[model samples]
Target: MLIVEDLLLLLLDDETGTPAKAGTLPYALGGAVLVELAMLGRIDVEGAGSVLSGPKVVAVGDGPLPDPLLQEAYDEVTRKPRTVQTLLLAIGGDLWKTVTDRLVERGELRRESKRVLGLFRTTQLPSAGTGHEARLRAAIRGALVDGTEPDTRTAAIIALLSGSGALPELRPQLAWSGEVYRRAKELEKGHWGASAVGTAVARTTAAIAAAGAAASAAVITTVTT
Candidate 1:
């Protein structure tokens, strides 16, 4: 029998705080994948859970393995990546829609596709270094494996993607500013008019305004051009 708690701990250790750990998204997604794998029979649930609970282990030689095992392993391998990607979409800050739409355009995901659809059929994982899409994918994956929180991990991933020109620069800034707002609220309870407090509020407001202006400009540009 699979020890649910042990599995959770192992996965959590690998994904905690990173994009994969963000909200309930990872658990929901990973659970679905686990179910598919279990049905396929590629993995013995108990054994698989044991392996995942510790250091990474090669599953022996194979082109893919049996459908059942393959399916289960596939989901397991991709859990962190998917979680990170969703986290990015969820808190993309100013560029939430833009980033996600672009990713869809590049075949990382299909905006109209259902989650139950097979990943191979519904989405094409981009080749590493192919473009901004690849970079974004890498960023999300990195964040998840590093055990960063979803929001914070997403922010860092956005920063990396933006730096690489995969994303527009303004979006990451906005996301970071939103974080500042949350932090500021906490600070306001104790520190009044402190430099950090003042800075946080100012940055948050500026980011919001910039996002709004950018959005408006985009609308105008789209209409005019």
Candidate 2:
């Protein structure tokens, strides 16, 4: 499974299917894909910086990825180099549906829709009872709670969750504690293996913060206006 899918599974409630940290979901998802691409050697940050005056992430290699989602993100990056912040939204905007659709197709999640008030419809993505997510949680819990050394992919997942600020939401499920929080913070500081992946995580962290501030400002404006 893709890192983004794993992150989603971790963030989503098993019984309710509702995702945590909904506002930053797109950026988190997009960041996951970028990190994966960097790990695959399909993308990187331009060493000289962009003409637009910031570090620009560029697509490498000419071939397409086998997975449709990765391919789509790669095609976007191939079009032009952009700052990590730009790519996060460019690649992540509207990705909720696409990524969720892929998970549904994989039978990892089940989608249910119901009419609300007889005229409105609502959708839910409850778990499909697959043991994969259970095992995933176990691994992450072991690393965060038990101080077990995580593999590369597991480390990346922890980094993404930490950077996106969704790790705390794991709550009683992961048995949150000072040790787990500290470990997550350490992962957030990088050392996840790849330099490019670390760069993406750092930039994505800033982007998520900025995006959240912007959203909050908009909400405040709406209410005050």
Best by lDDT: 2
Model 1 C-alpha RMSD vs. true structure (Å) is 20.1
lDDT value, candidate 1, whole model: 0.29
Please, what is the TM-score per model? 0.19, 0.80
lDDT (0 to 1) per candidate: 0.29, 0.73
lDDT of 2 by residue, 1-225 (tens): 998888888888877678877766777788788878876878766553432223577888777687888999999998987776677778888888878888899999999998989999998888897898888888888889888877767877787787667787863367888988888766655544343345554444333333333433444467679
The residue ranges of model 2 lying beyond 4 angstroms of the native Cα positions read: 47-54, 115-120, 193-225
The backbone clash count of each candidate, in order, is 8, 0
Per-residue lDDT of candidate 1, residues 1-225 (tens digit): 121111121122121111222232222223322322323332221111121121121222234644342334454443442222222222232232333344445543333323444544342222222344334444443433342333322332232222122222221222334444443333222122332323332232222222322333444467678
lDDT of 2: 0.73
